[model samples]
Each structure stands twice: as structure tokens, then as C-alpha cells.
Target: MNTVEAPIDIATEEQSIEVKTDNSAENESTNDTSNLDKTEPVPIDVPENPEKIEIARLSSIITNQTNEISDLNARLAACQQHYETLLNRQKEENSREKQSTVMRYAQAEKAKLDSDKRCEALATKNNDLLKEKDNLQVKLSEFKLMNTKLQNAYEHKLSELVALKKELEKTKEINQSIDASLKSTLNHLKGESSHLKEQRESNERLKRDLNEQHELNEQLKLQYKQLTEAARAIPTDDEQAQALDTLRNEHNALKGKLTNIQDENKLLREKLKSSDEDRLALENVIENFRQTTMREKETTKKLYDDLLAAREQDSVEISRLKQIESLSNQTLADNADLRQLLEKEHQLLELTQKLTEKNSILQSDYEQLQLLHKGTSTDFECIQKINEEQKSQIAKLENIEKSLRDQLKELDEKYQTVNKLYEQSAKQYDDSLSEIQTLKKKHQANTKDLIKQLQQLQKPKFTNNSNEHGPMLLTSPTKPIANKENSNDNSSSHGSPTGSFSSLNEITSLAVPGSDHIPRHTPAHQQQQQQQQQQQLLLDEEQEVIVNIVDIDRQKLIDKLLKQQKLLVRRNEKIEFLNDHIQLLTQDLQNKRKIIQTYAMNEDSFMYTSTESDSIKQQLANKNRNNSSSLMATLYNRATTTVNHTTNKLFEQSSPMTLETALDVMGKLQSVLEDTLLKNITLKENVDTLNKKMPIVKSASTMSESTTNEAREALDCLHELSQLLNTGLDKKTLTACVRLLEAGVHPDALAQIVQVLRSETRTTKL
Candidate 1:
């Protein structure tokens, strides 16, 4: 192979050098003739001067030389044509073998290249499918999480609805109880007010008359006491009689005071009992509040946990997407490496095939030369012609080498410029890549912060549960009223009137009615004066006692009313809080579901905003709370009629779709994955088929060392030849029309260019 390739290389170099020498010699002869033409122009008229005649001779010699140069140029052109004809004949003899070998090798190389490209494409497609599958899986997981979150939210809303129903029931019962209590209280107050007004008039009249009677009785008692003292000194019948009459009046006054006190005590006892019942009811209400607050706390904890889990799942899904992206990048890089390896292998195989063909050709040529060596003497002259042709071929080959070297130098300069441009592009790409990384990191950090904010938002809020049953007035006087009444009756019925009177006198004061004539100077007068002062003090004390009893009864009624009012207010506050909480939760659920739905729908939109959550809360609050209770009641009544009409519309409008919709999405994803998997399998099969059909089975390692080196050299030469031919064809393809309309035999520039292009394509394939 080396011997054959070496001779071809030497022949091409010699041919280029000979062409250059012939061209240079022709150029020198033309230049000398032109100089002669300029210095010694042919005289248009015959000149008889000796000098002119000498000039004419010189011009003739120059003309002869010019003719000679022209003849030589024509001879050179004939020789070149002859050499080309001989070469064409020789090429024709070997053209079929060389073309078949080259075509076979080129076809095999093209087949290998096409197969490798198909395999590379298939591999890229498979990688894309795998990447898509991974992306779908991540989406599937995210969708599942979204579905779960939606389900949890649905259940939570249901629970809230149930709780609200219960609360509504409780509120209704409370309202009923309050209505009943208020009605009863109103009636009682009405009766009490009317009766109290009547009692006030009677009491005022009784107090005035009783004060007059008491005063009269006191005056009489004072007189009787004096009469008794006088009677004690001297037994007077008239004084004794007067004293008994005064005692009778005093006894009557005492009876009236005792009856008034008994009535007041009875009313007080009833009020105390009512207060006790109210206190018990209020205690029960407070206990219920505590129980409800505990339930709310538990519900809040569950909601927080669900939210946390959803966030974690979202983060995991994002991480999975990142991993899929990285894996796809790796697959692309691996594909690029495979393509480079395939190209190198194709080059090695092509060079090896070329070496084998060259070695066989060289062996055949050696045998032909050996046979021709023993021919005629004329054969020696043919050998000399062949030798001259060989020298010209060597010169031509040298010129080709020189041209190739110049092309290489120009290509190197171009390559250096291209390398600089490539470096600049690489730097720009790196900067852009870094910017993308920084942006990604910033986005991640923002997402993390948003997640943290969401977590904070998810934290349970403490509902203020005020223990409002604290104002319990436990002043129920439970003394035995019946026993006291019996004892009082027995005391009034059995005890001697005067004996009781004497006993009552020690404990009470006698009031004087209209005795303003009593002197303060006399002992009796002073005694009467002191008794009147004492009686006045007793009347004031009794009046205050009567007032206190009425106040106590009214105070008990007011306390009950206040307690009921407080309970109603407290209950209203609690229900309002619950309603507000439910509304807030509903809004939050909607916002979260919207975020989840958005995240699930668009894989690229990773940045979900919690700020919108607050907006949703506000919107719902404004929407729900704008209507008062009356408006809400009206709307509720309208809902039944509108429900059927709006249900489908609302369902469609719902941003977070139902579990069924989510499930449908999952089904679609699975179907897509299955389709992708099927395509991937088909692609893999095609790649396998391509691999099976690829040629060049034995690798470079199977060839002998000498053959491998020769092949490497042949590969290098072939690569150079292809490059040279491609450049030469590109430059000279327009030099002549292959089908000339004139007499000149047109050069087959177009056909040769086509051949050169085909060979170049084959070399590139190799």
C-alpha cells in the first residue's frame, strides 16, 4: 500500500513541477519577443539605411524566435494532450475496478454514517421520551398531591358545613330560649310594674295613716304608763281603764307592721330562687363554649398538617423535575460523544479499505513491469517516454503539494479567526448560563420564602373564648320561711297581748301622732319627747326595710334579664366568630386550590404566590360579608331556585377541579406515557436494527501493525486528496462549459466537479 501510494504522490508532485517549468519557459520566450517588438518595430516602408536594415534583420530573428516560441507552445499543448490521452486510456482500463472499489467503499461508508446518524437520532428521541416520561411522572405526583389537597379541602368544607349547621341549630335553640325567657320576664315586669304602682300608693297612704295611728298609740301609751305609775301609787279605776284602751291600739299597730314584713320576705324568697336557676343555665353555656373551642383547635391542627404535607409534596415534585432536566442534559451529552466516536470509526474503516485496495494494485503493477522488461529495444524508448511523463507527473504533484500547503496556511489563519470567534461565543454562553443559574437560584429562594410565609399563614390562630359566666349573683337567702311563718303565727295567736306588748315595747319605740304640746322641761314631758324621737327612728328604719325588700325583688328580676342578655350576646359573638372562621377557611381553601391547580396545570410556572391567598380571603370576605343577615336570608331562599341553574356553571368556574377531573388528567398522563413508551420501544428497535446492519465488523485492532500504519497513512492521503480536489473543483468548475457550442473541445469541468463533490461527500461520511 505504501509503495503504490508513494509512487502516486511522487507522480502528482512531478507533474505539477513540469507544468510550472514549461509555463515559465514559455513566459520567458513571450516576454523576449514582446521586448523585441517594442525596441525594433517593423518599418511600414522599406528603409535603405544600413542601421534600418540591421534592425530589420534583428526583427526577423525576433519574429523567428517568436514563431519558434509559438511552435514550442503548440508542441507543449500537443504533448500535454497526448499525455492526458494516454492517462485517460490507462485510467479507462482501471476506472471500472477503482470506481467499483471506491463506490463500494463509499456506499459502505455512507451506509455506516446513515445508520449511525439514525441511531444517534433514535437515541436522542429515546432520551427525549425518557425525559418526557420523567416529567409526566413528576406531574403525576404533583397532580396526586393536588387531588389529595382538594379532597382534604372538600372534606374540611363539609365538616365546616356540618359544624355550621350544628351551630345554627344551637343558635336557634338559644334564640328560642331567650325569646321565652324575655317574654316571661316582660310579663312579669308588666305585672310587677302595675302591682308595684298600686302597692306604692297603698303603702304611702298606709305609712301616713300608720304614722298617725302609731303617734296616737304612742301618746296614749305615754299617758297610760303615767296613769299606771299613778295607779301604782294610788289604785285609780279610771287610769286603769284608759291604760287598757291605749294597749289595744298599740297591739293593732304592731300586728300591721308584722304583716307587711312577712309579705316583703315572701317576695324576696321567690326572686332568690329564680337567680339560682339562671346561674345554673349560664354555667352550662360556658362549658359548651370551652368544648367548642377545643374542637376548633383540633381542626386547625389537622388543616395545618395537611397544608405542610402539600408543600412538601410540591417541593419533592419540583426536585423531581430538576432531576429530569439534569438527566436529559446528560443524555444529550452522551449522544454527542457517541456521534464523535462513530465518526472516528468511520474514518478508520475507510482508510483500512483504501490501504487494502492500494496494496493489491501495487502488486499487480510490479508483475506487469517484470513481464514488460524482456520486450524489444523499442520498449526501452517507450520506457524513456514513460520516464519523462513520470518526471512531469512528479513536477505536477509537487505543484499540487505546494498549492495544498498554501491552502493549509490560509485554512490555519481562518481557523485561528474562527477559534477566536468560538472563544468569544463560548464566553458569552458561559455568562448567559451563569445568569440563568443565578436567576434560577433567586427564583428558588423566593419560592422558599413564599413557602415559609405559607407555613406561617397555616399556623393555627387562637380564638378568644371568654368565660362569660362569671357574673353569677349567688345571694339566694334559703332560710326556712314556712317554719318562720308558723312560729310567727304561734307567737301572735298564743302569747298574751299585754305580755307580748311588754315584750315588744323593749324591742320597739312608740310613735306620737300630733302631740306637739309636750314640754321638754318636765320629767314626763322629756320622757314623751324621748319616746317620740325613738318612734321616729323606728318608723324610718321600717320604711327603709320595706324599700330594701322591693329593691331586692326588682334587682333579682333585672339580674335575670342581664344574665340572659349577656348569654345571648356571648352566643351571638361565638356564632359570628364561627361563621367568620368558616368563611376565612373557605377562602383559604379556594386560594390554595387555585395555586395547586395552577401548579398542576403548568409545569413551568413553579412560582405560586401566597399573596393571592390574602387577596382571595379579602374577596370572599367582601363578597360574603357585604350582605347583612336579612340579605343572607333572602339569598338563601333564592339559592334553592338558582342552584340547578348555577351548579354546572360553578363547577366549570371552579379553579381547582374535582378529584374526578384530576383522575382524568392522571389517566391522560398515563396514556401519554404509554404512547411515549411505545414510541421509545419502536425507536430502540430501529436503533438495534441499524446496529445489526452496520458494516466494518473487524475493528482496527484485528489488522497487522504494518497494515494498520499503511492504512493510517492512506487515510491521511485520501483525506488530503479529497480536500484538494474539492477546493480545486470549486475554483475551476466555471473555467469552461462542459458542452461548448463552439469548435473547442470543452473541458469536462462540471462533470469532474460533480465527481469531486461526490468523493468529498464520501470522505466526509468516512
Candidate 2:
């Protein structure tokens, strides 16, 4: 009876445990609904003749099963705690993954921003390069125009020089003829002067002879007079008659000699008159020759002055040629610089491409990180679901077998779907990769074509330059030869014009801006020919140097461009290789992620499946024992369920409310409150300032009417004045009004002045 009572006491205790389990089951999640039906109490039968040994065996068995149940419950509790810890760890890992992903995303964004900035900078650089190219092109056009003009000017100067040379030759011929004629005239004049001197000496000798003959005639007349007187005194004798006869003969002979002498004297006087006339005519001819020579000298001097002026013009042309050479050199340097800038632009483009590729890679990495973060989050959720399932498994051990099979079917279906998705993704990835390869090949082909086109385009330019320069180079040497010939001819022809020519040369040399002048020798006339030859040689050398420098610069630029092109190609190849590498890495990362996901899913499925089998076995064993000890088994299950439910609830509620979490939340709230307080203080200060200004505003508005009216009137007048000023008033009138206003004249006075000015203007118009 006591044993039977003991069973009844056990039944009452079982009733209390069942009531507790019912309470716990009600508190548990809806997942345990199927197990709730099994918690109902089964009626117990007490035997009238109960055996002590049987009761003892039953009690002992119940005690042993209860101990096993308690142990299993403890183990389940430990597993639940471990699962909770694992969930917490998983959550922390997910949060950390989230943080890392966010950082990676931020880094990617920063890189994108940097790339954008670089692109903008490159765009600006491209614009600047374009502007420079335009400016250089304009400069080149100007240089071409200048070159054409210079060529025309040079041709004109050459024509002028030829004309001058012809004129100089004509003048030289004229001068030579004039000099010969003058020599002939001078010789004739000298012969005529000598004839005149001889004639005069003959005339003087004739005059002296006539004077002697006159004195002898006078002495004879005196002797004849004395003889006549003596004859008158002596009378007539025969001897005296003979003497008179002799005297008469002598008288007749003397008279005959005197008559001949007088005729000769008359002839001499006539000869003297003729000689005087010839002398006067010769003197007049000499004066005429002198006048002609003076005129010829003046004409020659004018011709020389013209030649010197032409030389000065030639010197100016030479200076201009120097300027052209300098400009050409500058243009060549500019072209080289432009080429370098173009190469830099190409490099910048390559850099931009590389940056774009890197940005794409970073974007991919950021996406991958995001996917990983998502995967972790999903894994965490799955783990939480698994933990919840584990708790439900503990609570509803009876239905675990059925639920496990369905869950396995679901998991299998999910795995199949995941596999299908992975396969599809792999196929897509392969297709994309193939497309990328094809695109790369096309791009490479296009780049090759473009390079060929560039080379083709450049060939024409180089060929044209070579063709043009060939003629210029050929022509250049001939220019100095021609110039030297001209100088030699000028030096040979220009004898008497040396002083004026030298002075003109000095002036021309000085007129050459920025040209270094060689100091002139004292005997410049002697050195002129040597200096001309030297100048010709210098000009030839300078031209050769210019041509060579241009050619060298062109070749250097071409070489540099080619080298830069090759470098760019190499860099492009490297970029392509790096891009391929990046693609491969990205593919590998994706594969790794897929692999990790597969591993996680497999682990979850294996864990879930393994637990399902154990739970099912346990349920089977419990079912077997239910026939013999249903009441005890029910009580044990109730007790275990209650403990598990209570523990799970406590852990689930406590997990999010740790000391650290509470502190973090409190700190956030405190910061928010502080921000709000600061905002409120700022608002209050703004309101106070507004309030303080309100009174002042009101007081000003409440000012005396007379002053306010005056102020308003002044403002109106100013506004009207502004409008009038804008209405096309003449500057003088406007300035006068401004001055009147500045001098503190009233608006009325200014207005009256303006009206008067307007009236005056109207009157003038009328």
C-alpha cells in the first residue's frame, strides 16, 4: 500500500511538472505546437497485489532514466549556450565584416573621386594644349606670311639691285667717255697756248727792228740837209756833180728798204689780231669743258647716292633676314615643345585609362566585399535559424523526425538551386571573358590602324618639308655668291665715290638693329673689298647653319615622337596585361567566395542533418519507452522542455543587453541630448539678437515725419538722377552735374542746370 502511495505521490509530482511544461510550452514559439498535444497527462493504474521487487525495479529504472534525461538536458543546455555564443561570435564577425566592407567601399569611392579629379585635370590640360596648338598654328601661319612677304621683298630688292647695277654700268661708261673727251680738249688747249706765246715773241722782235730802222732813217735825213747847204756855197764842179749822183742812188736804195720793212710790220700786226681772236675762242672752249665736267660730276654723285641708298636697303633686307632666321628658330622650338606636350597628353591619356581600369577593379573589389558582407549576414541568419531549430528540436523531440525530413528536402532543393545559379554564373563569366578578349583584340587592331594612319599622315609632312628645304638649301649658297659678285662689281666701279659710299655703308651697318658691327679700319676704302667678301662668307655660313638647325630639329622631333609613340604602345600593352591580371584575380576571388559559400552551406547542412539523426534516434528510443513508462517519460520531457525554454528565453533576452551595449546606447542618447541643447542655445541667441534689433527698427520707423520726408525726397531725387544719367546724357553735362552735386549743391540747383543744358542742346539742335 505504501509503495502504491509512493507511485501516487510520484504521479502528483509528475502533474506539477506537466503543469509547468504547459506553461513553458505556451511561452515557447509556435514551432512547438505539434509537441503541445503530447504534454497531456495519461491515467495511471495501481495494482492491488503489487510486488516489492517489481516496484523497486521500476523505481530504479525510472531513477536511472531520469538521471540520463537530466544529463541529456544539461548537455542540451550547454549546446544551446554554445550555439548562443557562436551566434554572438558570428554577429560580431558579421559586424566586423560590415565595417571592413564599408571601409573598402569608402576607399573605392575615394579612388573614384580621385580618378574623376584626374580626369578633370586631364581635360583642362587637353583644353590648354588645344589652345596652345591653335596659338602655335596661328604663329606658324604668321611666320609663313612673313616668309612670303620677305621673299617678295627680297625679289623686289634683287630686281632693284639689277636695275641699279645696269644704271651704274651706264654711268661708269658715260664717266669714262667724259674723262677721255676732257683729256683731248685739255691737250688742244695746251697746244694753242704755246702757239700764242711764239706769235707774241715774233711780234716783239718785229717792233724792235722797226724802231732801229726809224732811228737810221732820221740820221740820213740830217746828213742830206748839211750836204745841200755846202753845195749851195761852193758853186758847180765836176767832182761835186759825181758825189751828188752817188748820194741820190743811196737815197733811192734806202727808200726801197724802208718800204719793204713797213709792209712786213703791217703783216705782223694783222697776224697778231688773228692770234688774239684764236686765243679768245680757245679760252671760251676751255670754260665750256669745265662746265660740262662739273655737270657730269654732279650727275655721277647723284648716281652714287642712289647706289648707296640701295645698299642701305640691302642692309635692311639682311637685318630682316636675320629676324626671319631668329623667328624660324623660335617656331621650331615651339613646334618641338608642342610635340612634347602632345606626348605628355598621350601619357596623361594612358594614365587616365589606367586610373579608369583601377577604378573599375576597385569597384569590383568593393562589390565583392559587399557580397561577402551579405553572405556573412545570410550565414549568420542561417546559423540563428539553425539555433532556433535546435531549441525547437529540444522542446519538440517527438515531431523532430517528420520536420527533419521536410527540412532536408528543402535544403536539398535549395542546394540544387544554388548549384544551378553557380553554373549559370560561371557560364556568364566565361562569355563575358570571351567578349572582353574579343574587344581587346579589336582595340589592339584599331590602335595599330591608328598608328599606321598617323605614320602615313606624318610621312607627307616630312616629305614636303624635305622637298621645300631642298630648294631653300640649294638657293641659299647662290644668294651669297650673287651678293659677292655684286659687291666686287660695286668696288671695281666705285672709285671717286668711295668716301660717300663708305659713309653710306657705315650708316647702313649702323641701321641694322641688333647686328654686331665690325669696327671700321682707318683705311676703309682699302678694306672695303675684303669686308664685303667676309660678309658674304658669313651670310652663307649663317644660312647653312639655319637650314641645318631646322633640319636637325625636325629630325629630333620626329625621333622623339616615334620613341614616345613606342613607349605609349608599350605602356598600353602593360596596361592590357595588368587588366587581364585584374580580371583573373577578380574571377579567382569570385570562385573563392563561391567556394566559401559552398563550404558554409555544406557545414550547416551537415550539422543540421547530423543533429536530426541523433534527435530522431532519441525520439525513437523515447517512443519505445513510452509503452512501459509513458507517465514518467512525459514528466521528464515536460521538465526538460521547461528548463530549456526558460534558459533559451533568458539567454536570448540577455544577449543584446550586455553592459557594453547599454553603455553605448546611453552614450549615443547623451550625445544627442547635448546636440539638442546646443542647437536650442543657438536658436535662443538668434532670437535674442532679433529681439534686440526689433526695437531699433521700430524706433527708426517711428522717426519724425519731416526728416523722413526729406530723406525720402533725397532718395527719390538720386534715383531720378540715376535714371537721367542712364538716358544718354553727354559726358560734359553729366560731369558738370556730378561736380555740382559733389560741391554740395542742392538737387534743385543741379536739376535747374540740367534743364538749362537741355535747353541749350535743344536750341543747338534747332
Q: Over the stretch 8-102, how does candidate 2's per-residue lDDT look in tens digits? A: 55457557656755664454434234333432332366555557646665676567557656865775576556544543443344335444543
Which digits, one per residue and each the tens of the lDDT, describe model 1 over residues 463-498? 242223111111111122223333434444443322
Backbone clash numbers for all candidates listed: 25, 0
Q: Candidate 1 — which residues are off by over 4 angstroms?
A: 1-223, 234-244, 289-766
| Candidate 1 TM-score, C-alpha based | 0.20
In the predicted model 2, the residue pairs found to clash are none
Q: Local error of candidate 2 at 490, Å?
A: 99
How far does residue 581 in candidate 2 sit from its true spot (Å)? 99
* Candidate 2 local Cα displacement, residue 27, angstroms: 99
What TM-score does each of the candidates earn? Answer: 0.20, 0.22
Q: Which candidate is the best by TM-score?
A: 2
RMSD of each: 53.6, 46.8
Instruction: State how far residue 615 of model 2 sits from its true place (Å).
Output: 99
Report every candidate's CA lDDT: 0.54, 0.53
